[model samples]
Target chain A: MIGSWMTLPLVLVAAPPPPLDPDPRASPPAAAVEADPKAEVPPLPLRDARRAEQAPPPDVMRAADNPRVPKAKPGPPFYDAADEAVFRARFDLTKDPAPPPRTVRMRCLVADPLCGITVEVQALSAYALRAQQGSVATANARTWHSARAQYDVWVQFPAVVRTIGRTRFNVLSMGPKGGIVASDGGDLWANVGLAMRAFFGKGAFAPHLEVTGALAFRIGGFTEGGAGFFGAGRTDLGPVRSPVGFAMDIGVGLGGFGSLVIGGQYDSPLAREEVPESLRTPAAGMFYVGFRGNILWGAPAAAAVTTHVLAGRLVVPER
Target chain B: MRAGVRPLRGRAGVGYRVHAVVILPLASVLLVASLASPAAGSEAEAPPRTNRYLEAPPSSAPAGEDFGPFFTGPPASETSFVKAPRRGSGLAPRLSVRDGLFCFVEDAHCVASLLASTDVGIGMAIIGENGPDLPYAQLTFRGGFSLRPVTLYRKRYHPWALGLTASYSVGTGGIRLQAEDVVETARTQATRIALVNQLWLWHRPHAFHLDASIGAVRSGVLGRDERIHDLWGTHVELALGFGGWASLVVSGDFLDEDTRIVFGFRTHALAGVPVAGLTALGLWAGGVL
Candidate 1:
């Protein structure tokens, strides 16, 4: 045990004594540096060593300052809070809502030629778009200018003919029943007429006018002669009669999509009475008042063709 | 057989006797008249002067006139002549009267006459004269007036007259046969009125009358009890009148049913004045009135 104790002392003596200074050389230098009023400092090597221990790695510093880097403003918050609420209330965005496509519609109104106030309507489709265009427009800068207004006029040609068929004349003399009486024979003939019109205005406030003309042919009458009671054999009194004439009409019209028109016409004999002996007799004048209307399938302005119906009262003045 | 023969012989004998009796008398009369005619002619040709004494004489003869006993003084102006008065004192007074046939007036200044008449006719609707079916017949009635007055100094031969006619008709003659029914009953009726002026052109052996009427006609039909009425149907008719008091009138008329055209003729007989004593017979074919 005494030996073991002696070995332990030796072993203790063998262990290196605690160093009074961490590094004899480092301590002296550090002490010398501390002690010296102006010591020549070991610049490069020591400065390098101190910097290596204290400075952060480049990657770590980059990571730490990343939040402070200037960022894009997030772009006006994708959508406002109210906008989000509206979107959610109106549609189920999660379900993917579909968008409505664009569409366009157009219409028009038309007028009758015979009666100005008559309006008709017809259904039109895209096929009629080109024909219905009222004017061509061109854009200059920001303003659109129309080239010209185009008008489509409708005309009516009468299919049936009518005419003044016959005329009977009488003469009154000085005595109550006194006078030589004469009469012309009855005649038959045919007449043809044409009408046209143009309208201006919109909706129910539109106004229009129409003009019409008709030519009648071969209207004449015959004469007869003496008989009994007159105290002699039969003798024809007047000569043969012949008459041809034309009539004119003008009228004002007012109406809307569908319209009704009423107007009057004054007709004067265009030719003189052909009966030589009957010239002394008074001439007859004719007149008529008529009503006309249009039945339209749709809007008046856009219809391709409209049906017009007419009725009238005819009158002829006494000779 | 013997008895039958006896009766036959007796009947023959009687017939012969009657024939002889009739023939002998007629022959004798003819013979006597033939013999007497010559004698009468001879006596007439040779009148004896002795017969003069038997003739009635005298005061019948005018003075300064040679008078045979049998001669009557030129029958006192056989042609009566009325002497013209100095002024208007002898003028014939006007005559005016209204009768069933006509209205007549005769005056020195003017002669005026007016006549009004009405006629209604009904005809049978029989399939055959003795057929076993009965349907409604057709009936027509017409009434009108005529005015004729002779004006002094007016054309002497031509008479101015104005006539007005308004007639109504109801019957069942307008039915048309269809595929479903070979013959069907149709009830038709019409009402019409016309004002016509008759201008007499000739008044000799025959009178030529020209007349025209402007009028309205309303017609309807009940086909198996379906009513179809056509109003506002206007028509004008022209007619030619011919012959003497017995006159023929040809007329053309228009009706509103599909605007059909019709024509017809009528004959009339007259006696007396313009307004009176007239009768008419008429037949028409074409579209129904």
Candidate 2:
């Protein structure tokens, strides 16, 4: 009796069995057998199915709008459609064949020794295109690349100065109306030079030759009709005149890493001066020792201008 | 392999985060405490007292009859010259002891300078060396002139002064032995003199002074067989002054391609005394000179 009770509890805990299938030979109901074949089957859209299969993956489509997708993968930086379009236009990626060669034009303004401005242009032939297009045609075409050199010249203007030098004369008997007179005028002066430089190790040495010229004028007058004129002689003088003279100079500059320049210039006068027996004049062969230094505010050989201060002393050559 | 490496890195990251959290606050607290204590002490020592009469008595009263003459009445105005009434008179002689390390551009070794200045008047310095037994010893006599006269501190004209200095240095050094085997001992002596005529323009606000100097210098070096004379050169110096009258001067002297640097300190002491003291302590530290 206890075994029977346990079997009953076990049967209650188990699930019910599934129903058996109907036999094939069994007939169906009249209404179900009479259903139409056209109503039962739905038509498939072939074009839509094919298009869906050929489309890009869903992740790729999603990534087109998602920025985080690019950060997850290591590759070139991602660009939006507008940025990509701009880059494509700038680089001109659509061109099939090579474009014409580019023209390079250069212009320079050099100052030092002399002030000058220069412009250059040049034409370069496309070597590859020579097989397809004749040289004559390429030369005549305005669309071709070219470079040229032109407008090379130097312009210099004289620095003007007006100054007086010391005069020596003994004081003598003079009338109340006696006075001294002096005159000064402008002179044109210019210096022209060329330098060849060589740099080695930590030092730069340049050998240069320079030519200098000056146009000068001076006028002076002495007291006339002094008190002693009746007793002795009349004291009177006229203005003295002088002409311009050209000078030639040669020098070499020794420079180092720092903007240090030391040079010596020898100058020889092209003309001699005529002076009275009682007057003293400077000798012809006068040389000047010059030293210049620059503390450049920027990098060397750059376009930035440098400030340089120069000091010179003129030494008279021994007669 | 990946699983094992992952936990190690995770634990290391956690450890770093913990260390950062613990160290930052502790370091900040210590820094704040260190900076605040000195400021607090300075404030406590000079508390702002509203009772002018009671607070003024301790500093102004005479402890004895001799001190009675020293007490002048409260200054008539902020710019009044209560410290020293007379100008140009009651100028105290200054004595200074200076010591510092020095280097030269021409030499690899560094030397020390111990010197003193005895002031006969304003803008005058008499210096002599007293350091370790060096290769040379020098005696220098120097004097300077102020373009603007010295006035009492509070009544002084906008802290502007210009000056010129001239110095003469005489010294003797040991004979430098050459490679030659013969011991040729000669008079190891030299006389170096420099005349630095400068114009100094200075402007001051409170205890701070900014100064600039430009001048011409003439220096000469006389040796046994050679003499180098610099007829003319350029000198410039920029200086800053702080703490009432203590100043730091940085000077550069250019002679041809050579340059010299001079660094020094100037101090003014004994503020209320009749003869105030001026001291210059430091060195003409470096460069070719």
Candidate 3:
């Protein structure tokens, strides 16, 4: 009789009535849970669980988007603030969405072997950023190419001065200026020039080709016309003794701020008909030893902020 | 050769001579000292595939595409792409300060050639004559390009690399005349051209390197009254790269009328600060012990 009773309960469990509604969204009957409070709920399938995680409740989504809604309690972070800072610091500028900012500075320009200084305003044009808008993100991120145009004015003091032919001069003074035997004569000149700088590997270094057209004025001593600061006097008032010439110098310099530039300068025909035959210096070539100094100007801060935002947006939690 | 035009013997003076002597030995010592140390990047370990310029693709990089420091393709861009300039395309300039004895038969002068590397492996130099006659007398350009197809990283894939170099120079023919004094007939150009075959043996990331070039040259500049005097000669050079930034060079040109020997040191000046610092550090650490 007891066996018959157990069989009768098993038959009842097997012959349970079907659910009225066949929708997957319907909640499960609570009878089973009520009967066995300790029973574990079955886990969802991988695909369904992923879908559930991706698609939050409408109310929850709205609350998350609302600024006034209070945020959930804080959880443990995958990476520390220091790691994020490092990541931000190392972000490459070539990968930025915006075009890289150019550099501008006021520098002191002094070509050594010559005792003269000038203030110059220099601007460096950024390389064109050709981001593939429609391309894959990986492909867009891989393009790290760069180049720029570095332009500046070459201005000097005292005015332009005429130099002598066959008379060589050092950085300080001219041996003999325009046949006038001044003990120590200096050069007074100004130039407008352009430099094309091509960068290699993250713009840490570059090689540049610079060309300039210069106008040199004449300086006069008590007796004759010369070119110098003290030994020679002013002669810019006289009949256009200023010579127009051109110079080409190829060199390598470190950065926009401070650098050492060493190259050869070819000065082509300073004067021909203006000066006397004894003072005519058609062509002169000299070694260029230049130092560029950026004293007060600081680098642009936009790159850092852009990189920080980029790093934050791109950060992924550690697995 | 023209009259009243004399090649100034030891024209650079004693100060330049002293500087050349001091710099050469100091460079040698530094080179040897750096070579005795450990290689660079040993302290900071990198992931397998980080360096994009390596011959072999980094672990994370795509396979089968060409990658190197100097030899590579243009970047893929969705929009119109302006290709970036490559190295050795006259972008990274190499400057060498040469102080040597430029001799012709019995007469010799101390000359300085501030040579700058320019377009496509050619080095264009202005030979400055630190004399009473003229500031610069000649325009000399010479350089070599490697024939090897591969750009190796760290160490050279092959120890031997063959190259071809050409040298040409034009200047005054031992003549010291004012630019205005010389008429079109009195003006003369001294010209020299040579084709050299260079053999190089180097182990990069280390300091030891040796190269030898041999070639035939035609050098002359003997036209005073519109009379050209050109002659055939042989040119030879042997260079030893000691310091990571400098090299010791010994070159000779043997002609019928003018035979000369040049012994000098060549150093490099890089453009950027970070590059200079990193190169120094890398050379110091990666020096061959």
**Best of the candidates, TM-score:** 3
Per-residue lDDT of A201-221 in model 3, one digit per residue for the tens?
223222222333322222211
Q: What is the lDDT of residue B142 in candidate 1?
A: 39
Please write out the lDDT profile of model 3 over residues B258-280, one tens digit for every residue. 44444333332111112222222
User: Which portions of model 2 miss their true places by more than 4 Å?
Assistant: A1-319, B1-141, B147-159, B169-206, B221-225, B242-246, B267-289
Quick one: ranking by DockQ, best first? 3, 2, 1
Task: Give the alpha carbon lDDT tens digit for every residue of B53-172 in model 2.
Answer: 111122321111011111122111111111111011111100110100111000000011111111110011111121111122222223232332332222222224434444332222
Docking class of 3: incorrect
Q: Write the per-residue lDDT of candidate 1 for residues A242-301, one digit (tens) a residue.
A: 122444445556632233323222222223332122122222323333333232333322
By lDDT: ranked, best first:
3, 1, 2
Error of 1 at B89 (Å): 17
- Give the CA lDDT, 0 to 100, for residue A106 in model 2: 14
Total backbone collisions for each predicted model:
29, 9, 16
Candidate 2 A-chain TM? 0.19
Q: Which of 1 and 2 is the better model by lDDT?
A: 1
